[model samples]
Target: MPELPEVEAVCRKLRRDALGASIVQLRVERPSVTRPQDPAHLESETPGRRIESIERRGKNILIHLSAGHILHIHLRMTGNLYVIPDVRFRPSLARLWIELDGGRGLIFEDSRVLGKVHLHPAAHLARVLKDVGIEPLSSAFTLDNFTRAAKASSQPSKIFLMDQRRVAGLGNIYAAEALFRARVNPRQSARSISKPKLANLHTAIQDILHHAVSSADAAYAEPGHFAEGESFPCAVYDREGEPCTICGKPIRRIAQGGRSTYFCPRCQR
Candidate 1:
């Protein structure tokens, strides 16, 4: 799944290239994407509406439209969005395509078909995302706030971080990386962390996320070309059995909450 930084990269691309481009047409290549919800409402509400702006809320993209509607997109595992010249540019696994002005088209492709797209009234956008926790990149996510949130859970640190209702936009990749950076074990209970270590964890989380966004931008010529997972280098994520950057011990991958977590056993204690 695309985490915070990956989704931010997508949002930046959409805001730069697709904003102000009215949706000339809407095509749902996969009927399953429309779901039990009627596609007619999406077709009626999307077309002719200009994409005013794009914002990243947690791991989701909020497309603000001129028609007082917001197009919410959750690019779950193996899902990505692209802006290309032709609608038929890459027809392999496109789920939805937006025909925009200026002969450009935005395509949503998902190999697993787990991504979701919904049209919501702009006024109710808050309700749609009300359950999401505080944005980690925001100033509001101070050590005090993090401590308070952590007290509400006793799960492993990695699992606690991955909970969107506790701290928004964290996934296995970043959570593992953040725990490694903080020198904290992934299996440690959230409430068991000390104040000093909690402070370090908070700083590590922000630093890692910000560095990822910047590194992703520098690595790709176009924001639309950036992808998460292996595309971004990690300190200890998905490098199982490889030597840790800080310590010579082999990086290990363990299962936590049904997700893989990579960390250095020696360094991340």
Candidate 2:
């Protein structure tokens, strides 16, 4: 799944290459990708409207169009957007292809077919994303705000961090990495964590996310890094039995909210 950093990187690429480009055509390879909104409607309405701006809200991509409509796309699990020359060959699993005016095309490819696409009026965007919580990178995610939310929740700290309604754009990978970086146990009760630990966790979340975005910016610039597989730097994520970066003890893997969480037992108490 593409989290905040990966999604933000994609948004930056779109803003650079796809912004201001008028849509010449929209081809929906799979109708199910645009559920609730008819593919016919998207094909008819999306063309002729220029991409005004691109923004990232949580893990969702919002492409504001010339008119009142907004192109909303969620790369749920395996989906990715690529801007290639119109003459370039399309991928086998390409779901939606938006032909641009400058011989370029934006392709949305999803191997698992779990992604979502919607074209809705700007007025309906708030309703569509009403469940998304505050952006952790924004001014709203302060230490006080984090502490209050943590104190109010009884869920484990890792689960609390992954809740979209509480902290948007955080997934299993980053949550585990953030918790490990903060030296906080993933299984610790949210409310039982001390104020100092909560403050550390808050800082760790922002720091890790910022660092990941920076790394992604560099990686996306390199050829084939985004399209091809690239390993992301992580201290304690999916490295079960690996030596802890800080302590020599082996990194432990535990299940929280049915998701695997990796942490150092000696370093993260």
Computed on alpha carbons, the lDDT of every model, listed in order, comes to 0.84, 0.87
RMSD of 2: 1.6
Find the number of clashing residue pairs for candidate 1: 0
Question: How many residue pairs clash in model 2?
Answer: 0
Give the top-scoring candidate (lDDT).
Answer: 2
- Among residues 3 or more apart in sequence or in different chains, the pairs in candidate 2 whose N, CA or C atoms overlap within 3 Å are none
lDDT of 1 by residue, 216-269 (tens): 545443544545534567888879999999878999998888878899999977
Give candidate 1's root-mean-square deviation (CA, Å). 1.7
The window of 10 residues in a row where model 1 has the poorest summed lDDT is: 220-229
Report the error of model 2 at residue 86, Å.
1.6
Error of 1 at 221 (Å): 3.6
Kindly list the per-residue Cα lDDT of model 2 for residues 155-178, writing each as its tens digit: 988899899888899988899988
